[model samples]
Target chain A: MIAPLVIFDLLLALTIVALAVAVLCLRDLFAMIVVFIIFGLVSALAWVRLSAPDVALAEAAIGTGVTGALLLKTLHHLRYVTGRLGQNAARGLTAMAPVPVAVLLANAAFCGLITLGLAVAFLGAPAAGPGFEGLVAQAMPQSGVEHSVTAVLLNFRAYDTLMEVVVLLAAVIAVWQIERGLSEAPAPVMGVVWQGFARLALPVIVVVGTYLLWVGAEAPGGAFQGGAMLAAVGLLLLLTRAYVPQPGHRGLARGAFVLGTAAFCAGGPSGGQRGPRGL
Target chain B: MLEGFGAILIAMGAVFFVAGTVGLLRFPDIFCRLHALTKADGLGLALIALGVALLAGTAGAAFRVALVWFFVAIASATCSHLIARYARHGAGGVP
Candidate 1:
C-alpha cells in the first residue's frame, strides 16, 4: 500500500504536469510565464521529495527566480518592440499567428506520444541502481570537503566543476559583449516604496548570499546558490536603478568577472584531484 | 500536542496555498492577482516554515527553515511590486 507521503508525491507530480501543460496551452503570454514559474517551483518540490535539497535550492533560486524574472523582462521588452513595429505585428506575435490545423494536431499528437513514452519508461524503471553514492560517501572524508555534494563537485570532480564555471563565465561574457554599445537611458526615479524596500533588502540579500557561500562546506549551498541570490539582489537594484555600473569600473568589472575561473585554475596544482578542503 | 499543532499549521498553510492559487486564476486583473498572491502565499509560507521549524530536530535546522522562508517572503513581495509596476504603465493589463 502507498503511504501518505507517497500519495503526496503523486499529487505533487500531477500538479507539476498540470502546470507544465497549462503553460503550453495558455494563450496569454503573461499567464503562461507565470505558470511556467509555478512549474519550476513544483519541480523543485519534486527534487526535495527525492532528497536532493541542493538541486531543489538551485532550481528555486535560478530555475524559478532568475528564469521567471528574465522571461517576464523579455515579454515586457517584446511588447515594446512590437508596439514600435505597430499593432498588427504585435497582434500577430501575441495572438494572431494562424497555424494550419493539421500541423497543430500533428504536433500535439507527437508531443503526447513523447510524454506517454517518457511516463512509461519512468514508471518501469528499477527502484535502485548502481551508483557512486556509497563510494562518494566513503571517500568524502578523505576528499576534505564536509559536504558530500560539494566534495563531489569541487573535490572529486574539480575539473568538471571548473570547466562548468568557465563555460558559465564565457556565456555571461558573450552576453555582455552582445549587449555592448546599448544607450544608457536614464531610469525613472522610483517612488518611496521601492526605494525603501531596496534599502532594506540589499544588505540582507548580500549577507544571506555570503552565508550560503560559507555554508557550502557543510550544507546544501555553494557558489552557485550564493551567486543566484546575489543575482536576484542585482536584479532588484537594476530594476530600481539603484546601483548602476559606471563606465569607469569596466576594467575592474572585467577583472572580477574572470576572478572565479582564475582562482579555480590557480588552485588546480596546489589542490588535490577532488579539491582543496571545502574548495 | 505540539506535533498536532505542527500538523494543523501545515494544513492551514496548504489551505492558504489553495486559496492563493484560486485567487491567481480567478482574479479580474493582474494587480488583484498580485495582491492575492503576495499576501496569501507569504502567510502560507510563513506558517509552513514555522511549522517545519517546530518539527526540526535541531536549532540550526529550525533557523535554516526560517531563513529560507524569510528570503522567499522578501523575494515574493519584491517581485509582486515589480510586476505591478510593470503592469501599471499600460504594459500588461492593470487590474
Candidate 2:
C-alpha cells in the first residue's frame, strides 16, 4: 500500500499542475487571477511539506496574498479604463483573442522540452553528498543567531542581504515615481463591517509580523516574512480606504520605505568587522 | 484519544470544504453561492483549527492556531459582505 504521506505529496503535485493549466487556459481575467492565487497557495503548501516553513511563509504572504491583491486592483483599473474605451473594446479586452495555432504549438513544444530536461536532470542527480552544513555547524557558535538560516542571511551573507534591501528600496522608488504621474480618485469608504474587521485584524497582523521578526533568531521566521506581513497591512488599508496617507505623511512614508536599507547598510560593515563568517 | 478526536474533526472539516466547493459551483446566483461558500468554509476552518489546537503540544502553538482561525474568519466575513454589497448596489447590480 502506498504511504499516506506519499499519496498526499502526489495529490499536491497534481493539484499544482492542474492549477497551472487552469491559469493558462482561463480566458476570463478575474478567473485567471483567482486561479493564479490558488496556485501560489498550493505551492506554499508544497514548500511546507518540504519542511521549509520560511519559504512557505514568504510564498503565502508575498506570493499569494499581496500579489493577488495587486492583481485584483490592476484588474479593477483595467476594467474601468476599458469601459471608457467603448463596449466593443471592453469586450475585446475581457475576452482575449485566441493565439495563433503556430504560436501555440511552438510555445507548447518549448515548454515540454524544458520540462523534460528538468525532469531528467532532477532524476539523474547524484545522492546527497557532504555539503557546507558541516562548515556552517562549525561556525554556528560565532554566528550570533540560533537559527542557521537567520545567521546565514543576516551575518554570513550580510552584504548580499543588504544589496537585496537596497534593490527593494529602488523598486519602491520606481513605483512611486510612476504612480505620481497618475491621478488616482479616492477609493470609496468601506462599510462598517469591513472597517470593524480591519480594526480588529490590523493589530493582530502587526503583532504577528513583529513576532516573526523577533523569533527569526531562533526559528523559521525572518525579515522577509515580517516585511511581507507589514506590506499586507498596507494593502489592506488601501483596499478598505481605512487609512489614506495625507500629504503631511508623505515624507514619513518615504522614510519608512528607506529604513530597511538604511538599517542593513549600517549593520553590514560592523558585522564584517566582528568576524569572518561562512557563506 | 485526543489524536483520534482531532482526526475526526479534521475529516468533518474536509467534508464541509467539499460541500462548500460543490455549492459554489452549483448555486445559480452570486449571493447564494457566496452565502454557501463563506458559511461552510468558516465553519470548516474553525473545526480544523480547533482540532489542530487540541493536538498541539504547547499552549503557545494552540493559541497561534486559534489566531489563524480568527484572522481567516474575519477576512471571509468581510469579503462575503463586501461582495454581496457590491452585487446589490454597484454597477451591473444583480436584481
Candidate 3:
C-alpha cells in the first residue's frame, strides 16, 4: 500500500479499536450506545475501503441506523418503566451491565483465541475456495436474475429466505403474546419544523425504498436492504408522530410478514426454476 | 480539471468531518455535541457525495449518490432531534 493509504487504514483500525474499548469502559449507557453507533459507521467505512460495498451499506443502514435507534428506544423504555425519573436513562442500563472481572477476562481470552484461529484459517485458505465462484458463474445464466447475490437468495436459496421470513414472523407473534396487548400510540410530535419534515421526508423515503426494490433485481440492493429501508421509514414516521399504524393492525403486520415468504415460495417454481437444471 | 475539483471537494469534506469529531469530544454539553456532530457531519457527507457524483460516469450513478446523501442527512438530523427531545423531557412514565 502507498504510505498515505496505509496510514489511513492504520488510523481507521485504531479508531475502531479505541471506540470498542471506550464503549466497554464507559459507565454511562447513553454515551456507550452513542459510541457504538459511531463505531458501526466507522466499521462500515472500513468494509467499503476493503471493497465490500454491500456489507458497508448493510452495516451503515441496519447496523448503525436501525439497531442504534431501536436500542436507544428500548433503553429509554426501561428507564421509564423502572421509575428512574430525573436520572439519565444511562443509569438504568449501567445498573444491569456490571460484569465480574473473572468473566470479563474469560471473555477477552475467548475472543482473542477466536481471532487468532480465524486469522490462521484465512491465511491458509486457497484463493478460489473450491471453485464455488466458478459454479455460480456457470449457473448465472439460469438464475433468473442478473445479480448473483439476489439470484442466490431469491431463487437458488429460496428455502433459506422463506425460513428467515418465518423466523421474523414468529418473533413478532411472540412479542405480541408477551405484551398480551398492543402497544399504545406514541405521543404526537409537536413543532412546525418536525411537522414539515415529516410531510417532506416520508414520501422521499418511500420513493427511495421503491427504487431500491426495483434496482435490487439487477444490483446489490436486494430484499434485505430494500426492506430494511422501508422499515426505517416506518420507524421514522413513528418517531415523528407522522403516521402510526393502529395497534389493531397486528393482523395486517402478521400478514405482511408472511406475504413475502408466501410469494417467494409460490413464485419460485413458476418463475422458471431453471436454476438447478431439474427443479 | 474535474478530477481535481472532486479531490478538493472530498478533502474539504474530510476537514468538516474532523471538525465534527473535535466538537463532539470538546463540546461542553450534550446538546452542543449533538449540534456539532449533526450539522458538520451532514455537510461533510453531502460534500463528499457531491464530489463522488462529480466523478460518476453516468447520470444514474450521480443520482444514486445524491439520493444516498439526502437520505442520510434526513436520517441523522431527525434522529438527533429525537435524541435531543428525549434528553430534554423524559417520556411515558419517567416523570
Models 1 onward score TM values of 0.79, 0.85, 0.80
Q: Model 3, which residues run further than 4 Å from truth?
A: A1-3, A82-124, A127-131, A184-190, A245-247, A269-279, B27-46, B69-95
| lDDT over C-alpha atoms for residue B28 of model 3 | 97
Sort all candidates by TM-score, best to worst: 2, 3, 1
lDDT of each residue in A56-171, candidate 2, tens digit only: 98899878887888888777666664344345544444454567999989998999999999999888877686867888889899988888888888888887877777676777
Candidate 2: what's its TM-score on chain B? 0.91
lDDT by residue (tens digit), candidate 2, B1-95: 99999989998999999999999999999999998999899889988998898889799999889878888888888889888888777743433
Q: By descending DockQ, how would the candidates be arranged?
A: 2, 3, 1
Pairs of residues clashing in candidate 1 = A155-A274, A155-A275, A156-A274
Best by DockQ: 2
In the range B7-59, model 3's lDDT, one tens digit per residue, is: 89999999999999999999999999999999899889988998999988699
The sequence of per-residue lDDT tens digits that candidate 1 reaches over residues A1-279 is: 879998999899889889978988887777788999989999999999999999998898888987888887666556554354346554434565579999999998999999999999989987688678889988977876688887887778888878877777777777778766533544544456567778988999889877777787798987677778878887777767776777786677667667656877777422211111010
Top TM-score: which candidate number? 2
The pairs that clash in candidate 3 are none
The alpha-carbon deviation from the true structure for residue A109 of candidate 2, after best TM-score superposition, in angstroms, is 10
Off by over 4 Å in 2: A81-125, A245-248, A268-279, B91-95
Better of 2 and 3 by TM-score: 2
Ranking by lDDT: 2, 1, 3
